[model samples]
Target: MAYRKVHQIIQSHSSADGDGVRIQRVHGFDNPHFSPFLMIDELKSVSPDDYVGGFPPHPHRGIETLTYMLSGHFQHKDHMGNVGELRDGGAQWMSAGNGVIHSEMPMMTDGQLHGFQIWINLPAVKKKDPAQYHDFQTEVIAEKTLPDHSLVRVIAGDLTIKGDTVTGPLQQTGVPLTVADWRTQGAANISACLNPEYQTMVYVYKGTITIGGKHIEQGQLALLSEGEGLAMAASDAAGVLLLSGTPINEPVVHYGPFVMNSMDEINQAIEDYQNGTLV
Candidate 1:
């Protein structure tokens, strides 16, 4: 298999979203190579003051959102009567197709509050489709244990190692995507492969890891060049998130929480949201 090279490294910038909730904004509305995948927000806070005020109600269109909780609790409620509670190690996926109004509120008062929220864009063909939601508790999500006591959790894609396979819970529709988290123990290496044509990148969340001969530390993202597979080695205990997607190669116009093909579409989205049709 041809191994990809780390072409670019991006450091996260701190930003606030969801009603004063602070987070490390990794990538949003930037980096075209990460197409189909728009944003990656890392929320890690131990103080209740940093995460208490949650998103009350918001409208999103022409995109999909995935929230994975590491140590905190998040409750998701939508206008469609879907209520999902995400605790530690749990995840929630929402497809805001044509449009949807929802809110994600943190339920933790104290202790460790950490997780990630990822935004994936929808192609023009599927932008007008209906919205959907998929919620997964901690135990229901698929996970794999490597020989080195490392762990890999599949959130929306299938992963296989040494003839053992684990498939994620969510079945996506547009521009087939893969999102998984990998944890490696000291000096442990794991083998992984992806489609050569797909846009692939890795985000280091904890500790340090080496990918394509490049050392990546926490709070940084490594954008990989075209390749089929690679070995992810950790000098110390490390955790990383693997993200890849099939490119749509279409014009992406993003405004606030809406992503569409053109300015006209963006305007239409705004009109829909303003008219209370975004549900």
Candidate 2:
């Protein structure tokens, strides 16, 4: 019953990415231990001008990009001829193993446009594999309700609480991973069993939550120390996203959207994209 403690609390930074869309970036560059998992960005906009341009065609290699839409609509088209629309509660997981060119455009002009896009690194051995995509609509996602009226949406992997298991639609991954959005009400005990081998991070985007007796609120991310699980409490209505994954533990080189095992690989990727050989 060893519990994971909060190692560090990070405040998200405001940044622009993918066609200049404003977003709240939790982490990406400079943290090597967060291996297989590379970055996390939250895009939430109430103003149409803030997110209308959207992400145009772009190239990526040696990584996986996951897009989860919480509100509004997004149409995703890629070089693979995959045309997918992510509506409320839908997600698109793209494994840009070797290379892939894609674009995500918003379908709405007004109202709230919100979602998350995460970048995950690939191991050197699989870096040159063919690109692929896994799409999941809202109805396919799994969810669970705790005794205290708390709700947890299982986006990937599994969540075990007091011997009950809630599995997500994403069953296979390059590395073991778990992702979920949890909501809690009033003073409540929040618990989730996890693998001690994986790196864990929790981002509280709404309301307030406490971990290891420290309070964290909107724009804050908590890095959980190595342990088998999490056992904490939230004193108020709160919403947070929990992410955990096994570290790749290898040399990582990156330049913009391309991530590779060496400088040479990065150079090769750039050459491939420029020559229109990357798809």
Off by over 4 Å in 1: none
Q: Top lDDT: which candidate number? A: 1
TM-score of each: 0.96, 0.96
lDDT: worst 10-residue window of model 2: 27-36
lDDT of 2 by residue, 181-236 (tens): 88787767668899888898888877888877887788888888888978767778
